[model samples]
Target chain A: MDLTLDRIRLAYPDGDGVLVAVDDVTLTVPSGTTTALLGPSGAGKSSLLAVAGAPLDAPDDAAGAPRAARGPRRRARRAADRAAALRRERIGIVFQQPQLVASLTVLEQLELMSHLRGRPAASRRAHALALLDAVGVADRADRRPEHLSGGQRQRVAIARALMNDPQVLLVDEPTSALDHERGVQVVELVVRLARELDAAALLVTHDEATLDPVAARVHLADGRLVEAPAAV
Target chain B: MFLALRDLRHARGRFALMITVVALITFLVAFLAALTAGLGRASTSAVTELPVDRLAFAPPAEGASPTFTESEVTPHQQEAWADVPGVGAAEPLGVATVRASGESTAAVTAFGVRPGSGLVPGTGDGGADVSAGTVVLSRGAADALGADVGDQVGAGPLDLTVAAVADAEADFAHTPVVWVSLDDWQAVGARGDAAAGDAQDGPTATVVALRFGDDPPTADALAATDAELGTVTATPREARSAISSFTAENLSLTLMQVFLLAISALVVGAFFTVWTIQRAGDVAVLRALGASTRYLLRDAIGQAGVVLGVGVGLGTALAAGAGLLAARVMPVVVDVSTTLVPAVVLVALGGLGAVLAVTRVARVDPHAALAAR
Candidate 1:
């Protein structure tokens, strides 16, 4: 498994009590495969995805399950004091709303992935341009996000996620804002790109229409895994 | 600077307004510093320009500080100072303000010095020819009196010759100085002080000017000498306090400048506080993308540096130009102490404010960026 979640639990503060968002949920995604986490609103699908994207040290009160420790930036062998370095070098994220920086152009957005890791932009421009071409937005490389359409922005985001050739991809409701056709197209793009890059991909969403292209489907209900992830 | 520069370009309007505020604050601070120095020079230049190491004043009343107004150094005190070890030159310096008549009449401070005393303006270079009945007017005094060299000027019932118009500026209590011989000075003083019925044949100089040839007197020696001669001795800088209005005015203006500096720091800090809060979302996003706390701080502070550099640089240029123009009609000096020191201080203080505001970047949780917003 390129990614694993071993009985992870997450909670947020409620009015004088704790509200468990994710309860002992374990899941995995093998490399070169796309897995879909399907659930309704408030079912902790996003919460689970966040955990898989960047695992944390289990709290003292959490259920006695083994926690996966992410490594810190400076020391590779030591467990991460934070997930910042892990996210920068190995994990790519596709946020629900594209989340492209307003100041950066589409191409620069992809280049920023390398820049975040202290790589010079000149050293990554060719690869960034190729990623844009693969996502079919090479023509819009110089245009800012404000100038792009919703579909175009999503495409740019997908290209950005693959810029650093990440080992794991965490995408959250990328199609919630699109219509059926554009939504299917984004899903197909993610699935194809995951296979092309040979990376483990987790897609978190409640929409049932976008599940056909996913190679594995995991059912979640009320912050708990309802059934084991069924691979097609 | 990657994201910082882009943010500046994208939010040009907001950043420009911030820069303008910084510029205005810098201008106020720099201009005030120049004015403070200018006023200080105007207040103390007369005493400071005297070519002597120490000034000896007759011991004051029990609790009062030494002052030229109440000081009355006698010939005995002058002779005693000359007898002390390391005392190079001791001379009587009589100071008094009286009216001068040239093409027009004007008020002037008269400085009484003997022949070849070298305390009079232009005497060191043979420029001023001081005679018993001739006076050498400083540049300011000459301008005020409207008198030139060789003109006959009436100085209170005594017609005196203007030996030479010396290019020197010494203003005592806002009055310019005119150098005159000691004989003419006493002759002028006997009539001037005759109203009190204490005008007699005596040494009437206000203070004794001292110059130490080798090692100057230590604080202990100065105090011992003061005790022995029955006089108060102080350096020229210390004597500035003796000018009636100088201490009060200098203290008040210096305090105001200090307050202005503090206010400038607060203004910059407040501005950056708001700016950082507005960009907190961006900061979180960057943090989530693996940017270190150090990187984010560098970006924020780099942005501030750009703003402060341009704003302060421009404001300093404006103040310097204004100071030059104001010098024609006012006592405005444009020097390193007046201009560059203020500029450096403003930038440093403004940077401090910016740092205070942006340090919040370190505390922002990267998890907030992933939260559903």
Candidate 2:
């Protein structure tokens, strides 16, 4: 497995105590494969994605599950360092909304990812252009987010997420805002891009119809992953 | 500043509005500072221009403080000051406000110094003499009375000839000054008319100007001298408040300037506060994308600095141009202290306000961006 979440747990404040968002959730996906997390809203699917992407720090202990023991402060610092490294080296994200900055053009948006990674943007222009071409929005490189349609904007965002050639792609509801046909196309694009780029893709989706193209599907209910269907 | 520059380009109208506010505030601050400096110069130039380092006036009586209008240094007090140890020179200076007439009548403060005192105007190397029965007027006094060199002007009972106009400006009590011999000032002060007092018991001169070399007298020495001679001594700069008009005029103008500066800071703070709050969502998204808190802060402050710089630059330029034009008709100075200093202050203060406002970026949670997950 290229990306793994080893029995991760996450919690948020509820009243006085903490409420579990993801409980003992262990998952793994190999390179060049796509996995779809299917669940209704508030089923801890996004929490699972967040943990896998290292956006949320996993809980310190897993309720007596065998784990490495360390001081709380040391563990927290390690987790923080891991998250930072994950963001810089391994992970890419597609937010549910287009989440495009209003001022940046489509090409500039992708270029910014390279800039943030401390690469000279001019040096990475060809790579950025190629990624945009792969996402089928190379012709609209100069257009601002407002000028692009919803589907085109989503494509631009996907291209942006892959700009750094990340090893793991965490997408949040990429097709939620698209029509049925457009939604299917977006899912297929995610699967194809995952294969072409040799990246492990985690697609979180509420629409079950869009899960057919993904190689593996894991359903989530109330912060717990349901068992995968047995092979026939 | 990638996002900063792009945001400016995208929201030119809002940034332009902010810049205009900054520019106008800077202009007002610079103008007020110039006017304050100009007015202060007009009020205290006479004492400040005195060659001596200190002035000694008669200490006020019970329940009163020392004042140029009320305090007087007698001949005995001047002699005592001159004889004090470490004192270099002590010259009696009689200051009194009186009306002078050439082509027109105007209020003037006549400064009385002895012959060869060098404190008198036009007494330096190769300078023309201002003996008894003759006076030297400052440029302001000359302008006010419309008098020229060799013109005879009536100063109270003494009809004196204006021997020469002094190049140095000296004003007291918000009135232009005329330099005359001590005898002439006494003659003017003793004029038997209602404007001049006939009381012989009063002190001869208003104050004694003092100069000291090595081992200047300590405060205790000065206090002992004050007790013995019945006089009060002060540095020339400190003596400015003794002028009645200077205190009131400077206080009002300085207060207004301070208030304006405070308002400028508050205005910048308020504007940036709203701007930061409006961009909180963007800040959250950026943070979630691994943008450090420091990066976001730099971007926001850079945005603010750009607005402040352009705005303050424009406003300062406008003020300097207007000040130059106004110098001919009004008392306005357009120098670096008057122009550049205020612009720098505006940018610094406005930047401070911006920093305060945009610190909210540090507290924005990257978790909020996860809501879309």
**Candidate 2 on A1-232: residue-level lDDT in tens?**
3778788888787889998888888888889999898888898887887777675543424223354543653555456445655675677888888788888889888887776666666678998899888888899999999999999999998898888888999899999899988888889989999998899999999897877788788888878888753547
What's model 1's TM-score? 0.91
Task: Evaluate model 2: give its TM-score.
Answer: 0.91
TM-score of chain A of each: 0.86, 0.86
Chain A only, candidate 2, TM-score? 0.86
**lDDT by residue for model 2 over B76-111, one digit each (tens)?**
788889999989999988888898999899999998
lDDT (Cα, tens digit) per residue for candidate 1, span A1-232: 3888899988887799999999999888998899998988888888887777673432323322335433232232122225777877888888777878888888888878787788876579999999888878999999999999999999998888888889999988999889999999999999999998999999988887877888688888879988754547
Alpha-carbon TM-score of each model against the true structure: 0.91, 0.91
Query: Clashing pairs in model 1?
Result: A70-A80, A71-A80, A72-A80
Two-chain DockQ for each candidate model: 0.33, 0.30
User: Which pairs clash in model 2?
Assistant: none
lDDT assessment of candidate 2: 0.81
lDDT of each: 0.81, 0.81
What lDDT does candidate 1 reach at residue B13? 96
